[model samples]
Target: MSCNAASAAGPRIVSMNVCSDQLVLSLADPDQILGLSRCSRAAGQPGPAAKARTSPRLSGGAEDVLLLKPDLVVVSLFDKRATRDLLKAHGLSLVEFTVPRTLDEVKDQIRAMGDVLQHPQRAQADIARLDAAVAQVRAVASAHHYRVLPLERRGFVAGDSSLISSLLAATGLTNAAGELGLGAGGFASLEAIVQLRPDFILVSEAGNHAEDEGRAFLLHPALERFYPEGKRIVLPERLTVCGGVMLADALDRLTEELKRVTR
Candidate 1:
């Protein structure tokens, strides 16, 4: 379909990436979504699973999307190259988004999708709420200055270049990862993490048991003893994995978790 057709009553959209899936699901009308990526409903997929389940999950095929004749297809720069080429070959109108690294970029993305989905007001509303959430967190953070490390399995650290770091700074908390000289992000050794002595490590989950080598690393005996439940923050991967309206919820939870843990 020609791009001009999307100007009418919210385009029929197919999201080919999980991040964009979250954005589309957040801002689009139910009928406006034509399909979602196959991984859109995978474990830890952000946003509303019910809305995602209501649509067909694409199996990395562009032909089916062509048949659907969606007014727009959203993809990321990192999406499969062959599939992107195939969709381009068919001249399907497409919008591309890059992974956002800062809070402002996240807001821009939400605003962009808002226009794409014909729901600018909803996007603005979500942005306002996100701003309010940030304000709340800032209030709490101003009274407390602690370093938080957004740690992941295998000691992966979310560093200064990530959206999480931006959120941390915006709310008055510090990302301990930046202190380790990891600007974009990198892995940390157990010894390094212990030496850093962060006030808290932000984990995606609060698993006390290990299910695999990666999970095992996080639950290493030493970690369990040092960064136990009360010492670690449990912000689900779904909430922090991608930056979108979910960040509003993330910010709110950060507020509550900070209040609970510091008290």
Candidate 2:
């Protein structure tokens, strides 16, 4: 938790956000993990570093994190300001990372984390794998004719600067929402979505499946009616939430669905 820089090199690290928790755990040694957020250990949720979470878990909060005595703490912009301020007040060395909206931003974040962690090799390897996956999807999609609409109704649709939009472009799929001129993350009206009339619909396979809650705009009755006969792609939130190795996994699923729907 507190170490002079002279002796702090390669100090223990803790991640406070789910996405960052996963990424840091993936890149760090097991002994290097000080603790993780509470959400990381939840069953059936995309979570903290798998290895670190396999044993007992650490609760995510300023007090819990301070108790761990980590050398560096990775916090996301999405984390509460109070949590961050408390940790800083405790004299913990912290690095704040922005939630990436575009693919470039995602890659940049990965590399930046890699740089901070001194694990450039691991980061490079992951990025290379992602690049290969994107290329593979693009090749297969180019020969096909059907386009895709990266739809998310759990509140918002993928728009101009989002990672979903970046991946759609990488895979050679067209995004109908952007064509309709929606700006960013938030609810998209049903009428606006139907007017786009995309060739296929992509919806979250997980999250609250309720039609009335956080992402209900994507699950509106009108959407079902509009795309009843078209292809549908169901994706897990983690894949599209942040860009990382899991993205390739999501894209593979996407490529398979796109091929099926297009055929």
Candidate 3:
């Protein structure tokens, strides 16, 4: 469905997850965002996920969502089913999308959500802008020779099929983790990481606790012995969690840090 046609009535959208938060906020105008989940809001900033919090804060319950009187509710499949049931009971229109695992999935979700919001044109434009930003960063990476290792101690780092891994490849860096035979998901052993010896580490800030554990792994006696100081890089999970314009931000930070190390 093309967003070229103008709709007199725009849907009031409520986003329930971080990935959805990025998509819903980007495509909808301020007035269209009826509510945003509290998880989207990060430290000190008005939700790292949402561009701006024009929507009412949703605390994962049906009570406040009912108050929004939304025309459309967007949710993640992983979110509590009780919330979905409650919203549906009120006869509100609903759309659900799985967390994106590939860049193509990101684009598909954008287009799909845009169609639902009656603003496909805006979604196309936003996606184009996001693509351009990714290309810009990729151009810079094309000129360099960097080995990237997606780091996750508690969970396995991104692999060949993962979105984060695709983003790393998008920037022209080789993911050493994939090279050393870690498949598409979950925790990695310290010894395996040592064997990879990546030129740079792409640690995803899954959350504060996960980020802390990842950071601590860097300082572990075994890991430290393997990787010299100053070779590790920690990137906020938001940047790599989903394919968005923010990827350029991650590339900029990663490239800068990698350059410093290689220099």
Candidate 4:
């Protein structure tokens, strides 16, 4: 079936990816949303998760999405290729979004989503809020120079192209991964990390609790020995996973965490 442009108000929409789910819930009218991805309701998802409860959740299956008969389906580039291909074969109108690695890209995406949903004014308002929050953090961050490394599960470091790296730059902190010779992101050996000696290690969580083996790497004895307590910045996975309305909150949280560690 051929699809027409979205109506002035918007089209009936279903979001098949977790990140797309957040964007849809943030920008689309309640009446426009036909369904959201199941992961949108997962614990710790915050804003999107709360809103998702009011809508039906899909399991990212073409069959499930077909059942919704939505006028549009939004997805992430990383979403299952098979599912996306199936939807396209069935002549569904689909909008696919790439993962944003920088603040500018994030802003662009918010506006794009708004345009797709036929809510340009709402997108502008959201952009204004995001700009304001970023300015607030930038003002405080400009006064100090610190080196921060976004170390995630399994000793992987966020590269210069990652959102976390962009956030660090916006906050006036240097990304330590570059100093350690991993400009594009790669696993830093425990010994390499210890040598780099970043002023702070930005992690999704703190404390000794390791939810799994991947998490256990974050709590390794060497990491603790080098960057203990105040040196570890906890930004939470929810805020960093998606670039959407929650990004403002992520900036605020990062600014506070930076202040806490620097003090």
Candidate 5:
């Protein structure tokens, strides 16, 4: 259905992707949500996942979505194209969101989704909350100007153009990945990471525990030596993965983590 044709109270929506699930949960009225993706209810998940628990969940299948007879379906760029195609072919109105890499882009998405959901006032309120939270982080971050790197699983470093990098900037930290010559992000060699010696290594988790090979990179001997304990800041993956209402929490968490490490 076209945006003009959507109900003023908002369309009955089905979110087929985790990120979209969060957006819908945050922006849409509870009754407007027809169904949410199964991942939105995963154990220990953060952000809007909790709100998804009582809602109906889709199996990430076109048939399941079709059964709901939703007025609109939300997905992300990362979702399977065939599934999107199948839904579109069957005459479902769809909104596919791209991964946002900056605060401005994130706001644009919030506003866009708000427009689609017919909740412009709620979207503006969310944007205001997000701005206030970011300002709070920026206030503390502007003082120290630390050099930080968002070192992720499998040795990947988030570059200057990434959402993590944008968040780092908002928090008054420099993305060490830019210094290492990575623009959009890439795998940094162990030796290169060691040589850069950033003031702190921002990770999704702390401690020496490694859940898998990808996570093992964060626990590497070299990293441990350079960024032991207090030298690392853990932001939790859920906060950083997608841009939406959760970002307000993410920015607040960054500020707190920065304070913890800097102290």
Candidate 6:
């Protein structure tokens, strides 16, 4: 399964989830990637998005995957159960992953994918890359203690147990969601958001304009009055939506944003 073989002897891989798509695109050799799920196109990070476009897009159905005849099919635990059973019935090898909720899981996943792909070098490289970001985040967190509420569409919060919260806590930001009885995450009313009174609310995008009802909830006048441009930290949804190699870059972006706001 080594990617080093001159004739590309590595496993032909089809990734079923956008998150696994990112990992596969990063760790697997180009020839090893047989297909990527359509989710990657709309929600994956820009880097993975670009690569995915050049590769074949797949439906969740077993038909397309059967055509590819991939040696290994990378999937998420969240993928459709029927699809997985169909693939298994055909004797296709499958590797499943769950969402990483902590830095430890993050590291474990990279290493695991590397082993699964038989590309140890690629996995180690990704881990090394993430470790540098981890160090930077830890350094910043150690310096200051700010409370940050990870606010999302419809005022839903990412609880303290989330991967992003772990990343935030490493940088010394307290998860304000906990104070509002959202340790495991739940929606908050506009009034509840204002009253909770955190130092900042981390969002997936910038602006206070409403594109739809969900967006409108976040753009409510009450939120804008308190958490304006300088107050709302915009971390792109691509990075935070999935826990993968993209998070290393996300961590760097957060460090810069934190520095700017703290100053």
lDDT of each: 0.88, 0.71, 0.70, 0.85, 0.86, 0.84
Clashes of each: 0, 7, 4, 0, 0, 2
lDDT by residue (1-263, candidate 5, tens digit) is 56555575679899887777778889998888999987888874554655688799888889989988899899887889999999999998899899999988989989999998889888899999999988898787778778998898899998988998887776677898999899989999999999999999988887777889999988888889889989998888988788898989988888898778777
Best by lDDT: 1
TM-score of 1: 0.93
lDDT of 1 by residue, 1-263 (tens): 45565666668989998999999988998988889998988987787989998888888788888889887899999888888888888888789999999999999999999988889999999899999999999998866788999998899999898989999999999999988989989999999998889999898877577888988888888887888888888777778778799999999999988888888
Error of 1 at 263 (Å): 1.0
Per-candidate TM vs. native? 0.93, 0.84, 0.82, 0.92, 0.93, 0.92
Q: RMSDs, each prediction?
A: 1.8, 3.4, 4.3, 2.3, 2.2, 2.5
Which of candidates 3 and 6 is the stronger one according to lDDT? Answer: 6
Residue-level lDDT of model 3, residues 152-215, one tens digit each, is: 6553677787877776776687777666667776667888777777776766442223246646
Better of 2 and 5 by TM-score: 5
Better of 1 and 2 by TM-score: 1
lDDT score, candidate 6: 0.84
The C-alpha local distance difference test score for the whole of candidate 4 amounts to 0.85
lDDT of 3 at 96: 92
Off by over 4 Å in 1: 1-6
Q: lDDT by residue for model 6 over 30-123, one digit each (tens)?
A: 8888998877687435446667888888977899999988888988889999999999999998999999998778889989998887898888
The weakest ten consecutive residues by lDDT in model 1 span 1-10
Q: What ranking emerges by lDDT with the best candidate at the front? A: 1, 5, 4, 6, 2, 3
Q: Is 5 or 6 the stronger prediction by lDDT? A: 5
Between prediction 1 and prediction 5, which has the larger lDDT?
Answer: 1
Counting only residues 3 or more apart in sequence or on different chains, how many pairs clash (N, Cα, C under 3 Å) in candidate 2? 7
